[model samples]
Target: MTEEKYAGKNKPALSQSGVRWLWLAALVFLADIGIKFLVLDRIGYGWGNRIEILPFFNLLHVHNYGAAFSFLGDQAGWQRWFFTGIAVAVSLMLVFWMSKLPAREKWNNSAYALIIGGAIGNLFDRLVHGFVVDYLDFFWGSYHWPAFNLADSAICIGAVMIILDGFRSKPE
Candidate 1:
């Protein structure tokens, strides 16, 4: 048992490669928040009304009071705390995972960072406003896609990166 403990302690922490990936996660988080403030806030929520960019896309503004698809939006009022707790927990786990990655696995670190950043962004909103502000509408004809914000987009992108990384060869 003592030998096993000593072995664990001797293991090197995240190498330079791993730190770089973690930085990428931080960058993604900053970018997500920056875009929201520069574009969404400047334009003002619900101010654009509707600007059609294509047959299936439009820029609109909307605030979300609940989870995806506004889930639990109408609930008594516990969801705000519930979602907030979950996001915080997830963010912590992602960061912890990023720190443990091998030095050569930059892509994996980046993916984890993206996820952490996005989750934190939304978590910020939940903590401050009791809801997240969402504004990005995509649709075709009468069908309407759920409105989402920069944080949501980042999370999705990160998820894709993670999936892609899984197919790549791991460092020896």
Candidate 2:
């Protein structure tokens, strides 16, 4: 028996969608950097003010030389190059992933953009100052969340969106 043959299946194109994804990524990166500049100029590094917006929320400025919560902070000099290398590698991988995504995969695309922006934001800091500038602080009593910046927030939000999208059916 002859094998069944199929032809003319319509594959979704991603050229346009990839461009949009890139544009959004660029915008987020710019915004993240712009805010950092403003904060650096107006507030200056290592300077922060606290406002009681709730029972357990405050904004503050803190520079971190290591990973989250200042882990490996005491390494003295190795972490700067280490984290910078990691960020650069991840950014490159994410860009390749973004290019491979189909047009209908909006959620994935957005997630990629966020991750890219965040990576670049931190990468810039590491390259320029050897550390990251974190300004958002949250705490309840003696417990305090690690200080973070807008780039971190974007990365978190994008990750959540991607996880949620996975549970949903794939777009046609």
**Highest TM-score against the true fold, candidate:** 2
lDDT of 1 by residue, 16-135 (tens): 435556666567667766766655555556735766778888776666778877888888879989988888898787776655555565676677777777888888778877778776
Per residue, candidate 2 scores C-alpha lDDT tens digits across 17-113 of: 4435876677778988887787677664453465446787765556788876788878978999998888889878877666555555677788888
* Residue 53 lDDT in candidate 1: 78
Could you tell me every candidate's TM-score relative to the true structure?
0.79, 0.80
Among all candidates shown, the one with the greatest lDDT: 2
Q: Tell me the lDDT of model 2 at 99.
A: 53
Q: Provide the lDDT at 42 for model 1.
A: 53
Which residue pairs in candidate 2 collide?
A: none
The parts of candidate 1 lying over 4 Å away from their true place are 1-11, 14-19, 38-48, 164-172
Compared with the true structure, all predictions reach lDDT values of: 0.72, 0.74
Q: Where does model 2 exceed 4 Å of error?
A: 1-14, 17-19, 44-55
